[model samples]
Target: MPVSSATSTAESPPAAVPSATVPHSWEYDGTEPFPEKEPAAPRDRGERLYVAVTAAIVLAPFLALGLAGWLLWGRLIHPADIVLALVLYTVTGLGVTVGFHRGLTHGGYRAVRPVRIALAVAGSMSFQGDVIGWVATHRRHHAFTDRPGDPHSPYRYGTHLRGQLRGLLHAHVGWLFRNSRTSAARYAPDLLADRDIRAVSRAFPALCLLTLALPFGLGWAIGGTLVHALTALLWAGLVRIALLHHVTWSVNSLCHVIGDRPFRTRRHDRATNLWPLALLSFGESWHNLHHADPTSARHGVDRGQLDPSAAVIGLLERLGWVSDVRWPTPDRVAARRV
Candidate 1:
């Protein structure tokens, strides 16, 4: 196969940083040594709900799956839970891959208004931060991977065992609570300029509710019982989120620390391809290839690597929902192979 001519703008020179003109008092890129004003304390009902939901998801799977077994308890685990979990995981995971990372961040292909908005909404259900913030942080990660400025690098701390453990923890989830946030103004000016994306960002809380409620509603209607609804909410909403969180976080922590570096990338960038997570991560575990070629659309470029996200993008393209698809060629991939 040959590399497609539809490569994205990521291969071009960096965009101008209009954020440099932002009001100084309000700027919070988390890079300044001392900001004049701190990011305002978390307020709003939505903020509180976000915190609580995140906590529940992180703790629920353990009690439902592990602690209950320890006490010889049963009931929390339902067959329907597993089925819903897999189904929701597939939908929301692709939301992050095809929607947030590839479509928004990398511009691997172009989507029409309806398709773009749908992607954003579906990804919002994943309960990751809004699109602008996610893209900003990710772009920052690419700007400075495994270096001082990478938002979620596992190597943030030194290589000592204690440091590595601490770094892993930070990369996995601790970084979310950090005072410093990636500036969407600096990194995602394209998204910030889009009124539709801004509106989608504002609707994230409602989208979260929709994500949780849809599965539970379907379960109640299908199973005709409150227990069934609860189980669906438990598995598809909370447990599924936890599973997605760790897998996405693993790409941040584990992909950098472990796996095979079969492709070369920026000097000092530690990204590697972790095969164990290929299917679960929807091909994003091909971190080495992704880091080597950021806008290729397909991360798992090798034969039999199984990139479902790429396949989805392909389907969408053929359906006329996406255009300028960037399919990789053997020559392009061969150039990056170590």
Candidate 2:
């Protein structure tokens, strides 16, 4: 969310105050009153359908290519493939978890100039849209939560099985296809004002190309074969994106519908922690704590819960690159107990 500011004046004597007595009148005002919130625009059903169809078409070829690569070159799990997968996973996953979600979305901690730029670039390479767009959508997600204005609420279609299935698909990827985009002015004004962020967001298409090309380039450099490059691209590029997309989307879908809600939230805000997604989502599956304390740097505040993203933020703090970290205190967590 964008930072807010307030203006206040010390108490002053009223114009008609008695000469022998002091009078007090104080006034304060917050940043220019936010514009009245406009109702969300109506979604164009034809456009929505077109976007969904086009996404299927674009994504279908990649799925076929992945399957072919797996059949032809995935017979033996090469050590190189494993290493590359782990490396790419860490880089890209952290780029989203620590960089996009924590650093940018919540301002969990302050990052130095270099780290901030690098994080934005790395997150862009994840192909999850530009920093400003991502942050804007996320802020909206938190603001409206599971309500009508939420961009990807699983409950938008009701609890019936078929409705849920449709909602799941919508939350997972369908939301991206629609023509409607979040308003950055309302959600991410701070980022919009930054020239560097705008430049990075504008370079998103180029960064996406690099994401696919880098893995292939590395594969050929290491394995010295076109087949190796193809396999790496499948595993590290397409499959990885599909997996991350699902995991992140689950926070919007499954996380809100299933798992253990150990912490309390506002009515209708049903976020939960699903252990199965821990490692895959870089500890983001600890959704219960996340919603309970949205600004807390650590989502996995409970014992034995693994949160690599929080760990990285802690490390950055120690390095003095980030300050004002919002680590959750025991009292804060306890107050939100379900």
Candidate 3:
């Protein structure tokens, strides 16, 4: 049940877990003898295509929405548009949290065929890169964490406030446009071996189109007007994506910089649980516990800690769409207490 330096909670006493039931361990202590894993010939900011795409996703939404609100006044943001955005946000956000991070990256549970495919498709719609690429990047993050090789470590700059600001922006979204790409071959070989996942990864660009277009179509179908379709595209499609992206990225940026470290972990890792983001991030904001027990499936083990993604997994388990769930037990929590 034990793997490496990162998981303080995985090896819980028998009283906490029935036979220490959690299936996998996902701790990465740099002790494994760091190798030169980054691509020898890396892509840099000079890559115009990557820069343009990242810029559009990260900046265009704010510009568009800000302008729309000013010009359209009361007509731009309707109640129905808000509802549509919320629904799309939940599904796609879960796609990133439950589907990509937990299910795909760490193997926290076994998803049935349909559930797996749906998760892959939903996650792809998040515009967070294909499943394999996202997983590879995340796994690499865990492997190196705040160390030199960590792709998005906020501490990479100095500890001064000015340096911290630079690091914050770098971790938030600046690293994304960097020429260096995480080595998928090294970090996500298992996913690369899966043909079904490969097919979904290949369909990433296509799914991006569908994610936006589906909302537009649903809006038109519901309201029976071109204006409704446009609103849906704006609110549900662009705005929702931007919001979820920043929230997820905040786990890397703000979670490391600010928040409570309620659980034990390697000293330098600095992952913390930011409560305000619990609902919006689908429980992913409970990041300190996540770093403490990476493959536990449930990041929010405390009573009041809200984790909608874990609850959804529980429902899926009951429906037989997933199995071998690593629900956190009290013993595991106690064992990892700081």
Best by lDDT: 3
Tens digit of per-residue lDDT, candidate 2, span 1-338: 22220000001111232233322342211111112134646657887775775586348545845695666574844456557767877888798888888877777777887888888888888767778888878877776566555678776666677777777777777777754578888777778888888888999878888888987898888899998887777777776666666777777788888899999976567788998899889899999888887878899988889999999999999999888788999999999987
Q: Rank the candidates by lDDT, best first.
A: 3, 1, 2
What does candidate 1's lDDT look like per residue over 254-304, in tens digits? 999899888999866789999999999999999999999888899998777
Predicted structure 2, TM vs. truth? 0.82
| Model 3 TM-score, all chains together | 0.86
lDDT per residue for candidate 3 within 100-175, as digits (tens), equals 8888887788888788889988999998889988987888778667765678978767567777888899899888
Q: Mark the regions of model 3 whose C-alpha exceeds 4 Å error after superposition.
A: 1-46
Off by over 4 Å in 1: 1-79
lDDT of 1: 0.77
- Cα shift from native, residue 15, model 1 (Å): 12
Error of 3 at 53 (Å): 1.7
